[model samples]
Target: MFTGIIEAMGTLTELRRQGEDVVLTVEAPGLDFSDVKLGDSIATNGVCLTVIALGDKRYSADVSLETLARTGFAQAKVGDRMNLEKALTPSSRLGGHLVSGHVDGMGQVMSRRSSGRAIEYWIKAPADLSRYIAEKGSIAVDGISLTVNAVKGDAFLLTIVPHTAEETTIARWKPGHRVNLEVDQIARYLERLLQGGAGAQAPSSTLTLAKLAQSGFL
Candidate 1:
């Protein structure tokens, strides 16, 4: 699990094609490699990849064909900058929402503008993914957790604060660039289980969970 709060940005030093999979060599000096072991999960641009080898600052991981097919990583090139975040620790603060580091789909930046002290961007996500988009809802784009400001058909607008823009790789993004997107997993699951589900009835059309609990049935 992850918080979607990117710790640092890393650069792909090299990419080597090995059969259907490819090995990625990335350099992230600030990324603590001591606790990382082979097979440990790390989010690279919202895609969960395992650590295949650990070095002083550079590490290598193999990207499976399935992962490549599902994410924009397939077109990743050498020297590409990626948002990086290690798996969450129990003691770590939940600065962002629960992120499985799983990319659901890709979104394209359509337009950009400068807000007061932020950057406002319009991203066009896939049509199927728009079902998960909602105003004030959480979404992970390019590994950075952000809140959706407004929702339009097949697209949404996001305003990234200056701090976030600077700390994450969003500052480096350009219009038409493809970004990995992961919608709020909980919302998606609930929407599915509540509507058109096998036996899920309406999602408790009554009051609230607290009210129900206070009334004795949890």
Candidate 2:
């Protein structure tokens, strides 16, 4: 699991295609590599990639076709900057919401505008995932945890302060840019519980406007 808090910015040094998979070499000198090991997991742009090779402030991970199909990595290139975050440790602070490093879907930046010292962006998420988003809800966009200031249809709003823009890759984002999106884990679990757990169909709702009126709720 990850905290969705970006620790540092990393650059993709190399993208070597091997068969159907691609290997990524990321260089992040600013990140602490002392505790990182070959098998450790790192959240690269919100995707959980296992470290396969380790070096001096650099590491390599193999990206499978499944990940490529679901993430923005399908269009990633060398020299592209990415938000990086190490896996959560037992003693680590939960600075952000729980992130599985699993990209639920890809969202596109719909618009951007300036708000005082911050930049406000509207991102259009997938239609299927819209139900999971709520105003003031937490979301992880490209591995950086942020709050949803508002929601409209399938799009949501994010206000990025100067510190967030400087610390991560949000500054590089623009309209039409694709970003990895991971909704709050709690929302997903609640949905499953509402559906009556695994393998159970969603319970049908019998309440309606007429029932509300009968109960004096209207």
Best candidate (score: TM-score): 2
Residues 61-153 of candidate 1: C-alpha lDDT, one tens digit per residue = 999888899898889999898889999888999999999988899899999999899899999999989988888999999888899999989
Give me candidate 2's TM-score against the actual structure: 0.91
Candidate 2 lDDT by residue in tens digits, 1-218: 99988999999999999999999999999999999998999999999999999988999999999999999999999999989999999999999899999999999999999999999999999999999999999999999899999999999999999999999999999999999999988878766654555576657655555765798744
lDDT of 1: 0.87
Task: Please give the TM-score that candidate 1 achieves against the real structure.
Answer: 0.89
| Residue 128, model 1: Cα distance from true site in angstroms | 0.4
Candidate 1 scores a C-alpha RMSD against the true structure in Å of: 4.0
